[model samples]
Target: MIMDIIKQGGRARTTGRPRDACPYPADSRERRAWFEGYDGSAWELSTRVPHPSVALRGVSACPDAATVSNQAAAAT
Candidate 1:
């Protein structure tokens, strides 16, 4: 998966697609052709901190699914 985080109007928006379907591989001639055709800044590879939307809820950071299931069953 290749995620693209774009900065627009003071907020961050993300878009992505599977890497295998892309025509622009890093070392390929197709990548150079793609850049030449676009007017925007060149795409870059980067890592980002987790987005707030992905924050954990009602569970630990690394919860075990089986343990959570058992606990929920006990509560009912």
Candidate 2:
């Protein structure tokens, strides 16, 4: 398997080995500036992309059960 080189500080996913080669999220809200793992892990294997701002906005706009449930599901 190909190794994923994650930034120790910033949360960007890059294809190349160079640290600065990752493409950042275009949306300001989705953009992350830092990431941390205690055990000196190289990468976080994930299948989903983060959409925190959307989830936050959704929850804020409608704190109802249905929207919150949907957001929770999406996050997972």
Leading candidate by lDDT: 1
Question: RMSDs, each prediction?
Answer: 10.5, 13.0
User: For residues 1-76, what per-residue lDDT tens digits would candidate 1 score against the true structure?
Assistant: 1123222211212234332433556776555434322312344524322334454343343458768898999999
Residue 67 in model 2: lDDT: 78
- What clash pairs does model 1 have? none
TM-score of 2: 0.19
Off by over 4 Å in 2: 1-5, 8-46, 59-76
Model 1: residue 18 alpha-carbon error in angstroms: 15
lDDT tens digits, residue span 1-76, model 2: 0123223323332222344433445433212322221122323444333345445554453458777899999999
List TM-scores for all candidates, in order. Answer: 0.22, 0.19
Query: What is the C-alpha local distance difference test score of each model?
Result: 0.40, 0.38
* Candidate 1 global lDDT: 0.40
Error of 1 at 10 (Å): 25
Off by over 4 Å in 1: 1-22, 40-76
